[model samples]
Target: MEGDLGWWAVPLAVLGGAIRVSTPILFVSLGETLTERSGRINLGLEGTLVFGAMAGYATAVMTGNPWAGVLVAALAGAVFGLVHGLICSMAKVNDIAIGIAMMLLGTGLAFYFGKPFIQPAAPDLPSIPFGWWSDVPQVQAALNVNVLFLAGIAAALVLHWGLRATKPGLILRVVGDSTDAARAMGLRPAVIRTMATALGGAFAGVGGAYLSLFYPGSWNEGISSGQGLMAVALVIFARWQPLNCFWAALLFGGAGALGPALQSVGVTQGYYLFYAAPYVLTLGVLIATSSPNRALAGAPGELSITK
Candidate 1:
């Protein structure tokens, strides 16, 4: 079993897979972090992610431009976020329920419209080859990093800085902390939240674009695999910090790659158990960090979960 992949290649495979798989999670979690910072949770990003995947793939296939597809996917995601924000801004709407509804709606729309593009091949996003200096073929393959992954890292750094140093960031924090204070300051909480959610959705859409236009490079109904929903838990694990979100995403990605990495090294024993590593890790983190007596440290004061 190990004839093809040397034992030495196992760590390399795992590291490579972690970087590849974590890209989507990083983008989605960053988006969710932004939304949560505005005191709102968007559970429907799963649907948005799937929908964006479909839209991106279809656009690439039709236009023969992967970047265009990414843009369209972001727009589609923004539309979904805008709808969610508008509905949640109403007096009696439940953000969670509305998010669920949006998820269903976006997913349904994607499946319905994406049927035609499923069998067609779409243009793939380009990658940066960083393993040219290595003589090993496996090393070369492992280090062929996607452009989106690098962009996600840059985004994390920019977001972390922006949130801590920018005026808009301050406004968002204030609005998230207290609606009453926002009102007293003549700021519109609903509008601020709506915009934030839209921006968040755009980020998620880009993540979906990466999925369809890069790694897996395909459009399918089952492509997401709960990554969108998992991102919500990831945000909590990160304590709503963008930098933490980046690290948490990489950790989750590493857990996800454990099984495949083990198999590469001929360690197929209990392979199925390895497949469950990511979920197990997430559950363990949630359980270990949870507290019923108080909100999580660093959580926004106006977030529904905190109340």
Candidate 2:
């Protein structure tokens, strides 16, 4: 294990791990940000994430194209989002409740259909040799960033700008902040919300694609490993901002990478505890944010989670 390259590779490994481990989370948090910005939250994205992983893996196996798998995963995730949006839009329906149900439905469906795909190996997504200049193998390996991670960064920038400067972004904010205001502006709140939720689902699905088509590079029921659920905390920590989601994901990713980094340095003891760093951070953030004394700054007016 090189003992973390005589203690030097430790940081390098962590930096690499943060970028690699955070990709799926970055995607899901981005999706959740869009959904929440429209005054809705898809708690079932865990399911969407799992289902997308299955669908993407299956597609890559059948089509021999990792990109096709990613595309199909997005479409499949959109369908889940569309279903959630349409259902929640109905009278007397609770968005949170429907999201829970959707999560169950998505997981059940995936488990039933994904059984056959467990053992198959699908094509992996390619990585960019960003560390081409580095002669060290560890450095090169650490620097070989995946294309999707770069894409997620680009997405964060675009989403950040879009929400601040674009007309559609304005509508999303209006719908999230005040449904009545959106209606008064002659905009359909339900429609806008539905679209936003669908797009969010698509991004979450792409995250799934990243799991099956890239990192782990295979399909399995345990592939998601609660990362989908963790994305909610990530989005909250980001204060619903897309760019913040990017930073928050890296933070979580670094925490996630901590255990492996330690193991890489030949410190195998208590690695499990290190692995728990992200969940512990999630708990801390939630406990901190859940305080009744302080209002969540920058929260959308109509967001129900705060209320």
User: Runs in model 2 with CA error above 4 Å?
Assistant: none
lDDT by residue (207-237, candidate 1, tens digit) is 8999999978899998888899999999998
- Cα deviation at 153, candidate 1, in Å, is 0.7
Q: Which regions in candidate 1 have their CA more than 4 angstroms from the true location?
A: 1-5, 292-295
Model 2 / residue 260 / CA error / Å: 0.7
Query: If scored against the real structure, what TM-score would every candidate get?
Result: 0.97, 0.97
User: What tens digits encode model 2's per-residue C-alpha lDDT throughout 27-102?
Assistant: 9999999999999888999999999999999999999999999999999999999999999888888888998999
lDDT of each: 0.90, 0.91
TM-score, predicted candidate 1 vs. hidden true structure = 0.97
**What is residue 236's positional error in candidate 2, in angstroms?**
0.9
